[model samples]
Target: MYRMYDVVIVGGGPSGATLARLIDQSKSVLIIEKTDEKSISKLCGGLIAPDAQRMLGKFGLFLPKKVLVDPQMFYVESYDLETKNKQRYQRFYLNINRKDFDNWLLKLVDRNVSISRNTKYLSHEYSGDSITIQIEKNGKRDFVESKILVGADGSQSQVRRKTFNDFRYITKYISIQSEIVGGVILPCYEVYFDRGLTDFYGWTIPKNGTNIIGIALQGKDAREKYERYLKNVLGNNFQEVSRRSTVIIRPRRLNDHKTDKDNRVFLIGEAAGFISPSSAEGLSYAFRSAEALAASINSGKNTGKDYRKRSLRIKFNLFMKNIKSIFMYTKFLRNLIFKLGIRKL
Candidate 1:
């Protein structure tokens, strides 16, 4: 006979780890993580914005110096490649090593919460009152039973794909990032807008001694566009250290944010389309959604209904972000803002 856990969370990212940390200690919880500590480098810009800081404060968490990277940014330098327009906007961001940050969060989880590292969640089946999950680790397959299943996976969430299959209407972009060792370090974050390359945008963020050149694009020519931008920016002078790619979701409408299915299974973080459409920032959303879901579960009431109610504020926030994306992405409106020098420091 298999022991049934109170909760089984797939994907041990920020949302999953946070949920494990915040959920009722009496409940038996298991977290399935695909990557180990050494191989947990996620494809993210690693910039912690003010919203994420606020979430950390709420959790009574403090950042250690080991997680921070060098050359902290204080502002953003916006550029229009097509029009040659430039503007500097003040924005505070905490530069961090994403892998370290994620590992730190994982460490905060209670030792009682079983974390299966280097484990892959294959599928799940629901019976009368419990859900059975199939997972693989090091060529060995095993099964686990749970009263509740949570998909904290990510944009390409296996749990969400197997369960809800919702949020397909939300737009997805391919984000390509290349880390270069040799480049001129800028004091501010560099943002580039060129409609010819991509409908989204490109950016250059300076790390300790390296610089990350990244761009968001769609269609078959994504790599080609990213290569073009790399050539334009680095100009064959910098040594490319590494290249990473991932899918970024942009939720445009209110209906795109779906958090629960059937009161037993739930979604959180980017798996539930909680990312910002305008800024592509999801850390704060991840933290908030995980907290809300934990609260809903701990309440021991209608989990799904409570989760939906708790998520209304997040939905409203993303809705406002969608409205901002219009002014930020629309060519005419963006140019108008640039021309008028709105909010430029």
Candidate 2:
């Protein structure tokens, strides 16, 4: 059957949910989520700062205090790539459980939102103006037709596969993260880096009784490096990791002055390269980008051109990428970081 919608978002993560909420115009919306139910295990450490909050606040969403482990500080740890100088940098930021935070945001979205979980996107045929997406679930198949298609899916996004040019991005770093059993975590996001970590860092986020610890490493030696890091972190007495997960983040989205190109499709969040370079964060940016898209559509503006070209967001993103590339490209900036530093300047 052909279920028509004004907008059809392929992933029900933060960006998709936020987009559905932001578009105040009454239009049929469908969210196709591949993750089963409310069990989307988040691979992030869940940290937000003033800039992130400021962005989300524009859409009537901001960090809620109930979910915060610590609502006021971000910790950055630096290890001299050459000399092992352990420096910790602290910046005021809000912290929450990624799983909890995303879930909370989803619940706050308008009740008109209809989301189908565990539904995989099979394929989509674009008529050069509109889109028809085929999805399968529970041994049955259905089709969705929409005026606009949004790829809010993460790094391995299927929507990106359909809309992408033949360009392969700098698919950077490999992360191994999990919830820890017993540890005293500070009230901040601690970042640790050194030659052992190469182009990445290890992190420990506090959540009262438990701790969230992980590292981002690269190359074929990543598994060995991660194991070694865990040993060093736990003093070799730690038992098996509780739940290990991985994610591949882009270094920065370089080619686009504006991220999307087609009128029929748009990209937001990680799929759009909206992940912040300094902290590798996305939820707040996702909300911001989603809101930008909704606002453009509401004001009867052209999304593919007008908002893509004239919006302050696109300019800000390009600006952030330019400044952040320094961190992604070399260890030179690593030398300037203290064990504790601030988020801006």
Number of the top-ranking candidate, with TM-score as the measure: 1
Clash pairs for candidate 1: none
Estimate, for each residue in 1-345, the C-alpha lDDT of model 1 and write its tens digit: 676899999988999999999999999999999999999499989899889999999999999999999888899988888888878888889999999999999999999999999999999988879998999999899999999999999888889889866646778899999888876648668988988998788889988878888999999988888888887766777899889899888777777788888788899999998998888999999999999999999999999999999999999988888888888888888888988989731
Return the TM-score for each candidate structure: 0.96, 0.87
89-155 per-residue lDDT for model 2 (tens digits): 5556676666777777777778887888889887888764678998998869988898888888876
Residue 250, candidate 1: C-alpha displacement in angstroms: 1.7
Off by over 4 Å in 1: none
| Model 1's TM-score against the true structure | 0.96
Kindly give the number of clashing pairs for every candidate. 0, 9
With a 3 Å backbone cut-off (N, CA, C), the pairs that clash in candidate 2 are 75-189, 76-89, 87-339, 88-339, 88-340, 89-339, 89-340, 89-341, 90-341
